[model samples]
Target chain A: MTFVFRNNTIERFFSDGEYAFSGYDDYGAVPEAERYIWWYQVPVKYNQEQLITEVESYLRRLQWAVSQVGQAPFLILSLELLYDAGVVRGDRRLVNAIDAFNQGAWQLAAEHTNVSVVDFGAFLKQYPAAEWVDWKFYFLSQMIVSPRLAGAFGQWLQTQERALAFRRKKCLVLDLDNTLWGGVLGEDGIAGIRIDGDYPGKAFRYWQEAIRELAHAGVILALCSKNNEADVKELFAAREMPLKWEDFACMRINWSDKAANIRSIAEDLNIGLDSMVFVDDNPAERELIRQQLPMVAVPEWPAMPYLLPAFYDRLVKDYFAVYALTDEDLKKTEQYRQNAGRAQAQAAFTDMDDFLRSLEMELTISPATEVTLPRIAQMTQKTNQFNLTTHRYTVDDIQRMLDHGARIWTLAVKDRFGDNGITGLIIVTDCGAVDTMLLSCRVLGKGIEHEFLKYVLGQLKASGLEEVHALYIPTEKNRQVQDFYDKNGFLCTREEQGRKAYRLSLADWDEKRNTIYKIV
Target chain B: MEQKVLMVLRRVFKDATIDETCSQSNCKAWDSMNHLNLVVELEMEFGISLEPEEIARMVDYAAVVEIVKTKI
Candidate 1:
């Protein structure tokens, strides 16, 4: 569950699912199930001294929350001093206080792996400071932000959530010629290219510098250019070029169709085609890729080289801006390489079931304890694609469930090559209501979640439960699981507006757990 | 032109009951920050720039319409 630490009355702005709060800025005992958020809006009071003190205290509270959360991610929206400075005179004190708060937040996030700092200043810049707060809502409900900008604010917050969840594009495939340099590579040979000097070339140089920063931030850069391989090699060898060819992780320099080339790149990298961004100067190439590989993102090329900076900004904002990088993220390029080798090895198997059976998968199912509680709560919050009931729960709520006699089981799956730890969870109420069942997409195609659920059902039957009832709550991302319960031999009792309710008699239930997977 | 300006203000303030009497002193929603937003929206909507002096003088709805009319 998500917990919001709000200073102003923002009940109308945010949804009811988020726990709204006010009063003293402190993180005492953060409940194990709740993901903490620091959402304090800049106070509009005239007293600069109190504002400075309160801002300093907010940093301390955030630091304390980070220490308490341990491995769980804590989202901290950067403080925005949202008031008209013209009314308050030249008060450098407020400016200094806001700088200190933002600096403290960035420093803490750098030190703590779990803490992520989102730039609230960027959103604040969309409107003038004087127009940010409407006094009518402030006087009536103490709303910090103007209600008129609520729709824009909600969209920005959704982008923030995507960043926090690590749902970002993995690779960027760039085109050469006018896209990278100032002119076409074929028409203007290595010496004739305008990459270093004068108007349009200067802009191209700046764009290259920005892309180099993206590469430094761990986005795998690739080349998918239709150019002479030998000439491109010479260009890379030249010392005058601003960007080196070594910056790219992979290159596909050939005369072949881009759609075929992108497909080959996906095979070479072993990453999903959906996680690629293709940038090309020619609209024809971009359109071809878009038509053939629709999952791949094709950003429109700027008409002028000078527009590259703005284009780069849009690229980072839309695709590559992640909240924080994990250890897995740093080694993602290597992991993709390994997956390529695994794909080749799996070709020897005769059938799909044979390929899965040969993996010798092991699943560990156990009661939810302190170690697994946070992941269980997080799974409930973020697992939209494969969730059965879509019932979101907080750490505090899960702990309360345990205290009130709810049995929660988490499944950790491991195959021969790697261990996808704690990928599925099932929360069964004592009253025989299966409230939630969800699995991470990493282990979905293997049918591990189904086997895991069947094992739990078998155990529940042995423990004196006569019947088990379950529900399917449909969401935009969870259409794949609509017939999940029906497939498991449960009789559907109700159906309405994409939601389905089902019940199963334990006596008549089939306890057919897959023999390939060993339940520990 | 006056009706268009009023429509923008009403939408920004989220108060359908707003009229020409709305001003910085009388309308609570016309606070400092929102005052700036109203100015920006008006500038973009009417395609005109209001000087700092004229912006400050536009305290009430009647004054806003007068100042906006001169610029447009």
Candidate 2:
């Protein structure tokens, strides 16, 4: 259950009983809860001086409460003045005091990953300022928020909580004709298409700018249009639009079924179909995708061009808002583009060994440190395809394992194309049993997993370890790695219900590493 | 109209055994918070507003129906 620290009656807003509240204006002696919430509104007072003092005390109490909660999530709602009783005009003291508290909350969120600030002003903006509080209800029940808006408040709070968890969609696939520009490329031709000069073109220009910003924020862009490839390429070169040819990680500019094209784009980018959002101006195309691929999200397109900006806002709020961005997220688009580059480079070489050696791959393996711990935890949570014994972990769980003397190493793979940061992880118990092993799909085609395993086992043998144990737990997406241990010369000791256990003797294991890549 | 009140009471109190005889002194679920919720739901259900005096006097189901009948 979540424990809430509030100064007013907010139990009506969070009516699900999954929450426990503190006493009126209580911040002392916090009870143990799975998570915590702070929703302190500005206490109504006639004197401006007294109100400022009360609002100022909230920041200190919040800091103490945050410190007491340790690593649990603390959601703090910014203080909003529901009923301002100030009579003097041009009063700046109260507003400035409220601003200071909100600013301090934001600073705490920046310092700690577990602390997040929810914008309470966004919800209050929906209603008139006069209707924020009902005097009768306020006197009767001490509720600062109107009981009439309880339903809307509950829904808004749930969306904010979900956004805090950050399960944002990964890719945005676009349709070309009328979706990105005013006119079709196949019919209007390069010069005839309106993209830069008229009323409708200006609207499309703004929409393209919004989509480009989404790409820089780490949402992969793709194209699925029925226009000829040459025509689209010519238009991209001729028009001075916000999007370019290189912005899209993959494109299917052929006369093919849109569902099949979208599926191909997902495969090309190495992402799941569910993590994609498709935008198209044509309703028929949108309906086809909705029916054929139910997992992909198809948002309703606005009929008029001017409504595109509002539609973009709804898309971000619904699908792409995260609590915060990591360095890994900021570099996602570049990494996906590099994967496409490596694919083309593979097609040019006849020998697999030659391709591996010519890439100048470098693998750096190190024990988990403070700098790489968050990335390591994130990889364990997200990687699915190449994982053996699929086990998800958070930062706190990994820190506990490290305290117990478990050996956890992270592998950073860099090649001529780009740097895929901290893409592989191995967690081994102190007794030399492999608890978890996973590699991101971006760096999978070059035989790095086997080389990583051999290197780790060689280290164990050098330290006078005798045997190593491993297991392959079956999952829906990890079926390809069922015999991974068996292929690496591990003896399968037990096999039951799609689960396999293997043991390897370090004394007799081959310690040969692939000479193609440099290991440090 | 009485059955509508009974249904709203059942939903807000989360108790199916509630009938017209349920009152604040006897019912365990009709506490202060649920009392506020009931007022909000009644105003929304019957499109009427309740004064503070009427809400205070609505300690029993009969009083609740009587106040709502005068407003609508």
Complex DockQ per candidate: 0.11, 0.75
User: Tens-digit lDDT track for model 2 on A7-63?
Assistant: 999888998759999999987799999999999989878989998998988999999
Best by lDDT: 2
- Give lDDT for model 2: 0.90
Q: Encode model 1's per-residue lDDT on A224-320: one tens digit a residue.
A: 9988888898888973666787777667899999899888778766578999999998999999988999999999998888889999998998889
TM-score of 2: 0.80
Fraction of native contacts (fnat) of each candidate: 0.00, 0.90
- Candidate 2 docks with a DockQ of 0.75
After superposition on all CA atoms, what RMSD does each candidate show versus the true structure? 10.5, 4.9
Q: What TM-score, over all chains together, does every model reach?
A: 0.54, 0.80
Interface RMSD of 2: 0.7
Give every candidate's TM-score on chain A: 0.59, 0.81
For each candidate, give the interface RMSD after superposing the true interface residues on Cα: 9.5, 0.7
* Candidate 2 ranges beyond 4 A from true positions: A14-19, A32-37, A63-76, A103-119, A155-166, A344-412, A421-440, A453-482, A491-520, B1-30, B34-72
